[model samples]
Target: MVIPILMEGKSKYLSSLLVIILLAASSLAVHAQEKPRIFVSTDIGGTDPDDFQSMIHLLMYADRFKIEGLVSTSFQTGRKQNILDMIDLYEKDLPKLKKHSKGFPDPASLRNICKQGAIAWAPYKGFRKSTEGSEWLISCAKKSVTQPLWVLVWGGIEDVAQALHDAPEIKKNIRVYWVGGPNKKWGVNAYDYIAENHPDLWMIECNASYRGWFMESESPKDITAEAYYPNYIKGRGEMGKDFIHYYKGHIKMGDTPSLAYLMHGDPEDPQGQSWGGSFTPITRSSKTIFNRNSTVADTVATYGVIEWRFNGPKINVPSDSTVFTLSIGGQHWPGYYISEGTYAVRYSPKQIEVGEYVTISSITELNGQKGTYVSKAPWPGKPEPNDFKLEQHWYGDKPDQELFLGQQQGAKTVSKHRKAFLMDWAKRWEWLE
Candidate 1:
């Protein structure tokens, strides 16, 4: 028989202390589970009108993530007016959205967080100057005591790069996700400068794969103005209408995936795959490292010449033994190599079609060692169906700030799981019910 332990003297106090400790631990665990802290810097009012659509999508779910800072950074549309205009509409819709969930922050609260970054286009060098946006980013990243801040660069990443440059300590507190592709053409110099300097910084470059938002039209009837806008989204809510209003009712929140990935929970994992897409690791010797590191870089367009340039101290490979090849979209094309300052290999496809899943790759064998690099492309990245454009804007003195106004092939990728993202967005709207 065991003697019953009675609560006497110190035993009673000891039990009480244990209970209090457990309760404190539970509270800390719940706090740890709270949503992530996020900082968003956008280039809205730029050449493409889609950033407005993305802003609307983000505002609707303002409560899902802790929005620390909202910065307006642009190469062309270098003003905060666009973000303000969207906030004005958001102010009106906040109440309606709040009814569904209590996570929505007050409109004034968000407005207070809004600030403008560098107004001048990015210079040839990295972090040429600082701005209110960059300083805010640095401050926000350092002030956070809970979790790492996810920095979504919906436009150029000059501000993020600047923040890291100014305060290297924040590297332990911030992560970056940049939407490249056409934007990369403009920020190539900055991108190169940052990559060379901060090679180990946590950054995700999402280029072509962002096209998954547009979706491939199954029939001529789908994705039309009347069907998608008026029939499906026109009456959902102020947010829905705003999306279709200027967007003509198309689902082109191409930048939405950056936040959507966070919305899916566990923003730290990029390999498991979620609404945002999956990614793989790459090395410096990787010819297609930029594309391969990105999830959607090759999913948008079925045909395009992907050029890979590798810069190193000295690649001791013999020219006669070096070979390059492009493998994607069920066809393979040989690539031509040219070495001036860096090693360059360009791939052009022979058989390719739009609205189909396509991946671009450049494989090389140097002196006897072999390496293969692969990635996806968006429709805009493709030149005219049969024509090619000069990639001068990528490295020249000026920032190439034009939309890749290439002619659409009237076909979309069949493989992108766009419907999942669409359905998730619909449930948030009251009218959709």
Candidate 2:
């Protein structure tokens, strides 16, 4: 069977083409394994300091993150005048952002780049309703060529829930980065928001059953809700100084008769001492549908499966109601182990149902309290038992823009926490690396 085949110019060219095709396929494989695309959906004008700070960070990584679009949700609900006023304040103060932080973009410049001719800067076509917003987001996700979209929803996940229900096609295209819910203390509004409409879609409750909170205790002075501020903020420029002078009347801290929140770094939780990063994970299933419901009036989708009512370990809190610690789980041997389905969560002391999987949608914690975690738990959007109350609320001084701004200026103090937050931020920018 040894016949000498004569190789022509065409044969040589075909071999070269095959090599190029293989190289292209290998390059695509590498690209497919890259980081997720990030789209930030913030509840703009909600007066939440965390969302505002998060926005600054989002903008800082604008180039690295795909940032398909921005949507503003849950602004002050009643009164058109109040809404407009709040929007104006939000818009005006944007220019002042850079004055507070070197990492943040100049508000005016950011506006120019992102804002349309409207008071609000949502860029999706059509009326900027929540349903429409979610639809557009879904479209953005489906259309992304680089990676699966990670929706960094730093507000109510209602719109996204709606979008998922409306566009089943979008289910496979995105993963939600939810930042809401007070664990068991709060109902699954985000989950219910979609579940009612899309019965088949999975619900990754960020509340109940999910061991979604972590705790850390720092010095009394430094341990305020504004703990992460010092890691990111820098000096405000000229415009920021002007805004501070002019808009002094609008800033108010708590119910104080005259005083605003004191803007200073706490003496106890000094800039560089104890550093930590904390967040809770919600639960959803990979097998869930993409779109559950879509209409001219509303286009939403519900996608993903979440194991139901699965409970996990509970953290122990002190009678003082301030300090917290983890009920240490027996460390497992390196190799052999049974899964949760194969075993049960030892929740006998707390009366938590062992085998029930719970959904976690969001987590919140206060500044002063100590937080502890039962190290082994599924990440955001997985279910666990509703046993111990997650560490919630930051019991500290008045929350003010200035306090956050001050923290931003001194963000370097909590470098470890800052790095962790930035690592999540880095995930949004995986396409770059």
Candidate 3:
């Protein structure tokens, strides 16, 4: 009886030990399932207000995504000093609306908008950092181990291009989503640069000046290519209204006119009724430019022109063909708007967490629909359209939403930590779909 009793006690202890081990393992698995990490690289005030809008969106969605770092690049725009100061001020005071609004920025609520700028943007002056953009990107990529690193580029590819040229590891691991050219024919340097050095890296191109504006009409319902004016936008309430006010207030100078600013739909413009988001499907393809031999005589092996074809169709494209656009006022803007189009890739948060891998399924379709076929995968299932929420997301009730908007809009009546705390609170949404 004594021996039997001793055996039973020993068995119970072993079972408890097993339970502890299993629980520890389960905890580890859950911890490992955290969200995919993201990095944003932008040229603040570079092109249009689109990058500005993206910045706002990033601030909003800061919860669902882990923004390991933010690198604001400078190219084709202003030097780093002016750009940084402008961005610093902008971040300090992004105008927004109030009055019973949902997730929007309001001017009257949260007052000060000071946060640390990207490390490279320091010296608080307008000088460019000696550290190359690619080096920074490559360093960030190598440093991140907990999750995959995504590099979102909102300007010229010079920095990323430089980085890929310098670091092989960056070319292998980092995924790049850039908003720029392959305009119809000009500024093909990035494409040429990639072909020569970093061909393996994945890229998502958001074509430049892709969308335009629309004019106001009695029938606001007209089928239009431009941005839907005050009415449709107002539906988003104070936030949307404030945005339009800002756009109208600022866009009346330089190269164009009031009529050109007529609310036209442009992919690059942020003021359209049809707001652009991540899941809007895109197409990706190799960007290649073929030129004719410039020499008076074509040498047999040296200067002969090589004809190029896309798919199987014979394009009337010239080897020496050049693109030129003439404005209505007879202004000649010389160059081509060569675009390689944009590509869409889908990957799920869960799969990324479990497998530590994400895959690019395919480019978007020609009809502006998502692709029917995904080329490569260990995809958990088939590809489906993704409606992305703000990155680090915290879904709140109407009251919470109102509060959040109030904080964003600078109401002067709320907490200073509203934005920062809101960002912190967003981490709770990692498991949310």
C-alpha TM-score for every candidate: 0.66, 0.41, 0.42
Q: Residues 249-298, candidate 1, lDDT per residue (tens digit)? A: 66566677778768663556665455665443332311122222223324
Candidate No. with top TM-score: 1
Higher-TM-score candidate among 1 and 3? 1
Worst 10 residues of 2 by lDDT: 254-263
Q: How does model 1 fare in lDDT? A: 0.59
Better of 1 and 2 by lDDT: 1
Better of 1 and 2 by TM-score: 1
Give model 3's TM-score versus the native structure. Answer: 0.42
Per-residue lDDT tens digits for candidate 2, residues 108-204, read 4333223111122111111224454566676776784746565655445656665765676776655543433331111132343343444343222
Ten-residue stretch with the least lDDT total in model 1: 391-400
List the candidates ranked by lDDT, beginning with the highest: 1, 3, 2
lDDT of 3 at 339: 33
